[model samples]
Target: MEIVGSRRKNSSFSSADDAAVVSTIPLYRSAPELEVRLDDFELYAIHRLRVLKGISDGLSRGKKPNEMENLTKELWKVNMRNSEASEVANKDIISHYVLRLVYCREEELRKWFLSMETTLFRYRFQLETTDAQRALLKEFDLPYKAVSNAEYESVKEKLNQVVRSIGQPLSSADTIYYKVPFEQVPDLVATRRVFIFKGYAYVAMNQVVSLLMTQYRSHLSKALVLTNRKWTSMILEQEKDRLTPIVEALSTSYLGPDYSQPREYGEISLKDIDQVAKSSFPLCMRHLFEKLREDHHLKHGGRMQLGLFLKGVGLKLDDALAFWKAEFSRKVGAERFDKEYAYGIRHNYGKEGKRTDYTPYSCQKIISSTPGVGDHHGCPYRHFSEENLRAALDKMGVGNRAVQDVMDKVRNRHYQLACTLTFEAIHGASCDAGINHPNQYYNDSKNILESRVRATRMVDTLMYAEV
Candidate 1:
């Protein structure tokens, strides 16, 4: 394989700096051979997964370019620093190859991994200097050649015209264009970003980044498929005992905060539950809350879903009993509420039956659930019919435009993204962290509302002091 050590005079890394360049930016064309401890293997895979999840979440929340850049920088510092440390570089390579193995088992997982990893690669590529980019592309052995002075002299006007059409600055005398096959860059062609001449795309210096992205995506995608085919045979029987469990766990891992643990907060008051539900609950929880209020009872599924979410957001056992009792007693009476419903509520808090202290359901779990007739437990964005979803958005006071945007995501089967849009519309602000769990939505909404209340109180105090 052509590695980073081989450099031309124009390459970003000189002989002295090749080691640093090789360690920092990865093409992921080949798997790295390194000795990784079991602990480091698990930790590295989780760290990389966290970064990929961060990228996916940021995109779902409609983060702007600069905001995403900032997020990437922050995540990189914490999870993927581009340091000179050999361990850091080794971890980066091993972690990436490990995820390829983890996600390669399923077509859906492969597609998701490809999309997120490509976006990540593009982000890192764009951060590089032009010379570094050229060096990397050369190492990859891409066939695109730079347009010669004679060729540029003939087509400079046409290239300048295309540049002007796209509203980019005119190409300078020093600017270089690459003659790439038009078939390779359909994105630029379809978008009219590059000037097409005959059958070749005269990709501008800046536009070469897109070409690199396309090449890297194709390379990584094929690598993943090949990895999938080889996975089972590649692991020896002895190694399988050690590695198989880790692979299985990583494949199904939910790496978000542990909402199952008790949080530090005052117990939720029964009187404030209704207002809090309206202001802070995710649509799934909100639907369950409203249905329970209207009917004065919830079926087992709805109770489990909402009960655990309430517990996650800091509802104590006594308060949870009183809250459910007030609603259930309206129909079943206090006697029936204690006999049937109260024990189940206590079970969710680790007080009854097997006493498993259940955590709130994530968007993935909720989306995967099949809500039967008369059940309002599943994700609204996933389960609600188009008309029902639209009406729910209208009830939340979301504007028609935002509602349509939410519908678009739901149509694409992006249920969590749709929930994120609803959160943004209701709060009139972007959800920087995105909505993965009902409790996360509630906590984020509560914080936003509390901050607004504090701001309003400060304004009121200042006005009264002037009087």
Candidate 2:
């Protein structure tokens, strides 16, 4: 893999080094459980963890469910801590959260920031590049090929296209710029009426996720990934229900096109889906049944069959219940919702769901898994033991893990160890998708997710008045 960016790689290292295109390859060493970082990985990990810690802290403080939910949703943004700026007010209640973020330094953040440009900018060009070519070039595998200061600034300007793509920042708790599913954000920013981060904008609350943000970003958000094609009903055909927001994120001009992602290859192959599902399905199903039994203290044979089935199909809580409520109402009645939807929601995206129930279905797995849990929604890889995962990986020929070379990547959260291994397991090739599947993602996979979780934790902590 050709890695870009960082001082360690700028220098040289011993011949014995592994995956050592640059001496400082950010990796995770599972054997020793040590983290390796030549540069930005260290800082990225720190920033990401800090954010999650904060969010988690906010949640633990015992706010009402609705308030907690909205608070956590804000975790997606590095909040300016302003209620007015919020897209949705916490009408149910008010809460505050705090958490800690430790890291390498501003240099790493800057370096990581600069490197992300190559990935973001790759799609900005209207070239006739293939999806693979785009993925090869666009995905934000930071610290790209070096250039002179002038060249660097030129690239930086292009990146600013993305930054200004927001055109505004939410009252900066340290200004953060990232491309999201919303298209309308024109260099957007927002902040609490009070606490604002310097060097960042003070955006009105409405601008944060205003119609403009959603409109501009929506097309991108709904853009058919892996290609410039809009993921419209024409393409999705039969699977329209499955095309939730992940597809919506395709058109976001700022972040709509992810260069780092391999072209859509067209609707994630059934074969690939089955390949991954087979290895992960049983484990996930078994876990789901157990959660229902132990946590909710409920029992139903359908728990295994139907629960795992929907999970395999990738129905999220909202989507899943809509599916179930439709199905249940057909059989029982709308009242089933009080027993079903309420339970499912609590079981799906809610804190109650997260607190007790662990496994929930995601989009990709549903599209993939067949035979075992086909079209049902759920994560299959987690419950499978390392032994099973190894067997599966070996059968698929992608379970190889280098000592320090790849280990540091996972340990430091530079890569999604579990998900990468799963992707490789299915395709029988080197999968560098970089988006972390809960059980399978790698590299960039962990960043947004890890950060969100940490941000929520931070908020949770602060709300509890726990520094």
Top-TM-score candidate index: 1
What RMSD does each model have against the real structure? 6.6, 25.6
Model 1 gets an lDDT of: 0.79
Worst 10 residues of 2 by lDDT: 95-104
Query: What lDDT score is found at residue 326 in candidate 1?
Result: 89
Off by over 4 Å in 2: 1-276, 279-388, 399-416, 428-467
RMSD of 2: 25.6
lDDT of each: 0.79, 0.33
Clashing pairs in 1: none
lDDT of 2 by residue, 105-158 (tens): 123322232222222222222222233322322232423233223322323344
lDDT of 1 at 125: 71
lDDT of 1 at 31: 76
